[model samples]
Target chain A: MMIDFSLYVITNRDLSRNKTIIEVVEEVIQGGATIIQIREKNLPTRIFFENAQTIGKITKKAGIPLIINDRLDIALAVDANGVHLGDEDLPLKYARKVAPHLIIGYSAGSICEARKAEEDGADYLGVGSVFSTKTKIDAGEAIGAKKLEEIKRAVSIPVVAIGGITLVNLPEVIQSGVDGVAVVSSIIGAESPFQATKKFRFTIDYLRKGKIC
Target chain B: MMIDFSLYVITNRDLSRNKTIIEVVEEVIQGGATIIQIREKNLPTRIFFENAQTIGKITKKAGIPLIINDRLDIALAVDANGVHLGDEDLPLKYARKVAPHLIIGYSAGSICEARKAEEDGADYLGVGSVFSTKTKIDAGEAIGAKKLEEIKRAVSIPVVAIGGITLVNLPEVIQSGVDGVAVVSSIIGAESPFQATKKFRFTIDYLRKGKIC
Candidate 1:
């Protein structure tokens, strides 16, 4: 299964406001989200599993991959397309051993972590808090495009820029040579998730074409 | 906060059947479950968080502590009483650093792991698949009461025996000096979760008196 790294939306319930996560996700998908990751840090296990199953069906129908954030059991339980692990979550090698068929993405804060993730058989890397992020208070200081570029060059696997990614700064992130961008508040917290997603999709595509030229 | 590890019920959604996880959990709590860990391995992040919040409320009102299995983020988000982590989940030391007030339990397969978990500030240790559990296919072989005893001896912290524990084997596990027993299928899978929990609680208390005598 080829996993698309473009326009990946990681869900945050706190950012979704009054809308349910499913509602936000569906809108984003309609607006051309290439991939969806359920990154909620607060839901209880059963609800999380049910949501994954629900979202998995939607993402499957849309022909886009759904990745469960942090929990491997949920990914396997929902038969999700993949799982995304943070630096503190399960190690990539062990996660790979347990779920060989699942696409695994690891959060990388530095070149060392990125290289190790690639060596450990991660399918892709979510590298950042590229700018200070409200989504995760302790995500650390912004790594900036310079370090993101360094990480991109250091690892063989695709790197997705995350944390504080927005339309205003996305062109520079794309210029930094990241394979994709992961958004949280900017999309899910928007007045219209669909419009926000569409704007991001357009910007990403435009930048990629410019890079190719 | 002092956590009562006695009658720790780790939930499995697959085993819960017709009732919701909250319904099953509430039933078990009423039947004398001391600690409740929402161990649904398949829930999506939002659902897991919401479930934890809901269950946390229930557990709190009853004065029974709630532990979220594996995800520290969810545990913190829901203000859960604690978190239970396997060898594959977050490291105990880091989890402690992040959530100093939360009660942390680590699953230990060996004496070394058990001791390390204690040193790393784990509130308790969950040892086994002591009877070969179908619940965790990869839980490996049953470590038996003998290893459970050895782990108990090796670790200064409280030990909770888990995996395939039932009314039949409850006496033997109790004899092994476990501070508590963590159950999945034996309770949640039973026809009446409340009755199953009552039976386990009664046996545990009876065994404790026997040990005291």
Candidate 2:
């Protein structure tokens, strides 16, 4: 399946505020989020699996890809379009060997990691906290646009910029030539996830059209 | 952490019949099942996480260990006492390196795999399908008691006999010097999970007392 990484929304139930993760996801997808990643870190296994299946159905029906974060078993259980894994999670080679059909996205913090992921057959790369942000307390130091650009140049696979990304600074991230922008609080945590998603989609389209930031 | 695998009950929700996995688990624990493995392969991620937390809490209060099947993320998320990995799951060495405190168990079908698991710092080995059973369609051929004995001799760590284990065959498995017995249908799928658990517990205790089968 060809995965569209543009305006990828990583779900954060804690940030959803008065809304279930599924509700926020529906709104975001309706507002033109190209991809959805179920990234809840603390939900019990059952809840996470249910949420993934619910969102996966929506994404599948809408022709959007649903990427499960960190849990390959859950991804397989839900028959998701793909899986998104971090450095601390299972290695890419093993994931590829086990689930060759799923599009595997690996988080890379450096040129070496990006190259390694590409060599290991990762379908895409998540590169960032291009800016310092609180969404991930342990996202390490911000890699900045220079490193993001370096990573993009170093790898053949598509790259999606993540971490602390918001509408205000997305232009700079887009300027780094990332294939997509992954957002958390700026969308799901917003007063209206639908509007926030629309704004992000508009900005990405405008920037990608070669408009000056 | 020392894991007591004496009467390990691997949850099979499909075989559970009319009861939730958590409900059957509670009854089994009350009937003296020592270790619990939440092995639901089809549950959504959210439901699995929730079940793990609920079961983890109950097991923690009862002083029993809960082992999550396959997904290390769920094990770490719920602070499970340990994790059980199949042949196709994450490599043992990497799992040990990442989660040093958890008691890791590996399933092995041969002496080489058994010895390798011990060398990789696995806390225990689950050697199985001692008698042909339909529970695991992909469990391959039955290894029988002879192979189980060889596996026990090959690995220094504790060994648990799994696959088609029931109260009727518990004696033969125990006589092979296995530290524990893992059950699926014979307990959870029984007409009364609680009563079945008690019977298996009694049989294990009786065999451990050096009585003839």
Q: Give fnat for candidates 1, 2 and onward, in order.
A: 0.00, 0.04
lDDT of each: 0.84, 0.84
| Candidate 1 C-alpha lDDT tens digits along B20-123 | 99999899998999989888765655567677778989988998888888877677656778888866566666567656877888888889888888988998
Q: How close to the true structure is residue A196 of candidate 2, measured as C-alpha lDDT?
A: 94
Q: Please give the distance, in angstroms, between residue B172's alpha carbon in candidate 2 and its true position after superposition.
A: 16
TM-score of chain A of each: 0.95, 0.96
CA error at residue A74 for candidate 2, angstroms: 0.6
Q: What interface RMSD, in Å and to 1 decimal, does model 2 have?
A: 11.1
lDDT tens digits by residue: candidate 2, A94-185: 67766777799998888998899899999999987788878872246799988899999998899999888887888889998889999988
- Model 1, TM vs. native: 0.55
Poorest stretch of ten by lDDT in candidate 2 chain A: A41-50
**Interface C-alpha RMSD after superposing true interface residues, each candidate, one decimal:** 11.5, 11.1
